[model samples]
Each structure stands twice: as structure tokens, then as C-alpha cells.
Target: SPRFIALCPTTLSSSSSSGAVDEEEQRLRSDLRERFLRTLLLMTDKQVEFNMHEKVRVRARFGASDIDVLNFQVSGLETPLGVQKEALLRCQDVISCSFEL
Candidate 1:
């Protein structure tokens, strides 16, 4: 999967000659991916503010992301021009996103 590959380091260190280190690295990557997915789940249906490139910022109801995490589906997106009832934001363009607990 591209997502899994993207989450991993492209190269291994010289010390990674041991299988144990490879296993540990894989475990850590799995843990990180799980935590990220959990955070996204917690953000579901909540109001989220997304800070994007070019200093663009928008607020919208958080929706689901694709399996690849390449895009986000949102509702009531308030852009500088006007409010968009629904929109898909590319993850590459987004710098960060946040929501209140």
C-alpha cells in the first residue's frame, strides 16, 4: 500500500542488519499509524479548522478521509470567498487541522 510505504523510512540504517531492529521499526510504524487513525476517528463529525497553503484557512464539519489519506470530505466549508456546502480538501495542501475536544 502506498500509505504504508509513505509512513516508512525509505532507507534503513547500517545497524538495521539485525532482524530485531527491523521488527521494532515495523512495530513503531504500526503504532504510529494506529494512533493517527484513532485521532481521525475522534475528529469525526466535529467542527475542525484547517490551515492550508497560501495562508488559506477554513472551518468545516469534519467528515471521513480516504483510506490513502489523500483527501478529506467536509461540510459547510467556510472559505474566504463564501461558504461551501461540501468540499474535498487535498491533504497535500493542508498544513494542519485542529478541533476542540
Candidate 2:
């Protein structure tokens, strides 16, 4: 197997104008980040896989490394406006998403 490399690795946390981080979201982000950083940060170009027509998680390919999603978070950009609608729609399509370790 090829050794994974961190092209731009750094620690990150969430902050809002109100400076409050939702615990659940924080946990989810933390979990995703932990999974991502433990391996390699697959480039952002990796395919966006639809696991159940509703659940969408980026899949890291050959050139990509497993990366904590937070590692890819923008410094100041906020969440998407329609993100909630999309998430709700996804949830309706898939009961849950499971990742392979």
C-alpha cells in the first residue's frame, strides 16, 4: 500500500457569529474529522458518492486521503442556506449512513 500524506493538515474548530457550536454537529464533525485525518485527505475532487440516493458522503479515491471533514472546513464560510432541506430530504431517502472502517 502507498503511504498517505497530509498536503495541508491543521487543527480546526467551529465558531459562529454568536460563537456557539452545536454539540451534536460538533460531535458529527469530530467523528468525520477523526476518520479523515487518521488516513489521508483525499483531494476535494474525489467523487461525491450517494450511498442510498439520499445520503451523500465524499469518497476518497486513489489520490485522495481519508481526512477529517473539518480539515476541509473554510475559516469563515457559514453553512449552506438550503443545507437543512437537503439533509432532511436525504434522511427521508435513507434511514442512516454507515461507513466502513
Candidate 3:
């Protein structure tokens, strides 16, 4: 993952002394990534509200996200103008998103 690589540049380089520490860090990062992916999977097809930049908020049915989690695909996206049948939201514009159980 590009984000992972950017966050942990040391993982890409060779370091013998901290190899054990690197392995542990990699394991923890893997677990976190797995959990995040599972959460996204659970959010699929659910009604979600996305809070975006400039105090913009919209609701939609969650579809899927790109592999890098840089964008979200949604259906029935409600906006100020009208409801969009389908839309893709940039993750950078979104501050947070939520859905009820």
C-alpha cells in the first residue's frame, strides 16, 4: 500500500539491528489494515452519512471503495441539488462517515 510505504519508509530499507522491531511493527500494521478492511466490508450496502469539507453532509447507500481507500462509490447520493443515482466521493474531501447498526 502506498500509504503504508509512505508511513513506514524504514520497512523498505535494510536494517539488521531493528529487524525484530520491524517485524513486530509490520504485524501490527497488518492487523490494523485487516480490521479496517473488515469494517469497510461490513459497511457495504448500508445507509451512510458522509461529513465532508466546508460543512457539507450527504447520505447514500455505501457501495464499495477503491483498493487504496482513496474514494468511495455510493448509490442514491443525496446532495443539495438533487439525488444522484450513483456517485464517487473523494476520500480527501470527507472528514468522517457514519452508519447505524
Candidate 4:
């Protein structure tokens, strides 16, 4: 018991360690969110290609996305059957998406 107590971290040290970890996690989250927002801004009105499951691919003009990333709003969507003026594509159906510079 004495050896275990000596090996265990003190309350203050443990709290500091937890605080450092939380700070690091917050920093990473903020960085990622900023980058994603920038990417969305750059993608506005640009031509984007969406690759979906079952080998289905489509091209559309980037409009916007919901805050939760659940759906994407696109314009001039080109599909196999026909073209859609505007449509909302569910993120769940998409495998990947890309755009050119």
C-alpha cells in the first residue's frame, strides 16, 4: 500500500495533467474546424465531384452544407438520368468528394 501510494500521482498533478490534455484537444478541434470552414469558403460555387456507393458518380456546383454535415446543397447536379437544378445530397450516401483548384 505504501509503494502504491508513492507511485500514484497526486491530486494536483493529476488535475494539471487533465487540464493539459483538455487544452491540447481543444486546440486541435479549433484548428480542424477553421480549416474546414476555409475549405468550404473556397469551394463555394466551384464545381465539385461526388463519388457515391455502387459506382455512382455525379458532378455539381458547390453551394453549402448543413452545420451537422448531414446534407450538402448543390446546384446544377448532373446525374445519370437527368440534371437537377438544385438538390440536397445526403452525406451518408457519398463515399468521397473532390474539387479542382
Candidate 5:
């Protein structure tokens, strides 16, 4: 699916949005959440999602500033009953990169 191709985290972060933290990161994160929900939609009879909370931990590059992101949806799909193996990778703090989206 075309959307699946857009699922590439790096691509979405670098190409789809502007900047790393403000746009790229957030868009990519939300996209992943939506994809997960879409899959669940195909499985369950009714809508079965209320929110999506993702805890992202990032390290500092050259300095001593860390980006620890605590993302949670106030209103959305309900959290899945059990979270077993989550395929998630946290992108550490922005160090010395000039990525202007």
C-alpha cells in the first residue's frame, strides 16, 4: 500500500515535515500510531481505540541536553489490553545535524 511506503520512519521524519522535533518527529510518531489503529480496525467489529501514548527517550549529542518525550493522546482509541513486543526505536537528542525540513 502507498501508505505503507510512507510508514518508513526516517522518510516521514526527514521528508514529510519541517524540522526534527516540531514537525518531522511528531508527524512520524502520529503516523505510526494511526497505522497501528488501522490494523486493529480491520480486526475488531467496532472502533477499538481511544488513545496512543508513546514514551520516547533520546540522548544528548555534543552537549548535555536530553529529549525525553512523553507522548499521550488525551482522547482516542483505548490502550490495548496488553503490550508485548513493541517495535519502537527512539531517536536520541539532536546533536550537530543541519536537517532543515
Candidate 6:
């Protein structure tokens, strides 16, 4: 196995130590979270397609997601055997999900 070695400094120096950095970080996090929540709200009752690892894919009607975003509650989940009335899908199992904007 070949390993690459760093030839330069790997860290950058920062001088700003005020609370401004914390405030800005919080603001950005809040804004991003708000956008994500709005997207979830809009996706409710709409069809969504999920792509999982190992080339597995599924389609379901969006219902809701947990606060931690660890799981999603969906309805009419299509499986290989049949459609499930309702199901909870682990977020970690999903590689990506998509819906019409």
C-alpha cells in the first residue's frame, strides 16, 4: 500500500476569539435547519424516492421524520413483495432521497 505524506502545514491560524464566531455559526445552523424543515413540510403527502446502499431503492409517500432525523415515517412503501401500509426507514440506510421541488 502507498501512503501520501503531507509536505505543508495542515492547520490554519485564527485570531478571532470573540463571541461573534459562535453567533455566526449558530445563525448558519439555524438557517440551514429551517430550510431543511421547510423542505420536509413540503414533501409531506408527496411521493419520494430513496436510494440505499447495495443498489437498493424504494419509493414511499412522505409522512414525517424524527426530530433527530434518524428515521422517517412513510406510507405506501413499495417493496419487492408488496406495498407496506406504513413503515419506519432508518436514515442511515438511505444513501439519498429525492422529490420534485
RMSD of each: 2.7, 16.1, 1.9, 10.1, 17.9, 8.2
Ranked by TM-score, the better of candidates 2 and 5 is 5
lDDT of 4 at 89: 94
Candidate 5: global Cα-lDDT? 0.35
Taken over the whole model, the C-alpha lDDT of each candidate is 0.88, 0.34, 0.93, 0.86, 0.35, 0.82
Selected candidate, larger lDDT, 3 vs 5 = 3
Best of the two (3, 6) by TM-score: 3
**lDDT, candidate 4, at 86:** 92
Task: Supply the TM-score for candidate 6.
Answer: 0.80
In candidate 5, which residue pairs clash? 49-77, 49-78, 50-76, 50-77, 50-78, 51-76, 51-77
The segments of candidate 3 whose C-alpha lies over 4 angstroms from its true place after superposition are: 1-4
Say which candidate scores most in TM-score: 3
- State residue 90's C-alpha deviation in candidate 6, in Å: 0.5
Model 2 compared with the native: what TM-score?
A: 0.22
Q: What's the CA error at residue 23 for candidate 3, in Å?
A: 1.4
TM-score of each: 0.81, 0.22, 0.89, 0.80, 0.25, 0.80
**Candidate 4: tens digits of C-alpha lDDT, residues 23-50:** 6766786899899989988998999999
| lDDT tens digits by residue: candidate 5, 1-101 | 65556556665556645465556566778998778665433433332222122432221111111222222211122224433222222223212222111
Instruction: Sort by lDDT, best first.
Output: 3, 1, 4, 6, 5, 2
* Superposition TM-score, candidate 3 onto the true structure: 0.89
Worst 10 residues of 3 by lDDT: 8-17
Rank the models by TM-score, top first: 3, 1, 4, 6, 5, 2
TM-score head-to-head 4 vs 6, winner: 4
State model 6's lDDT. 0.82
Q: Is candidate 1 or candidate 3 better by TM-score?
A: 3
Error of 2 at 6 (Å): 21
Q: Is candidate 2 or candidate 3 better by TM-score?
A: 3
Clashes of 6: 0
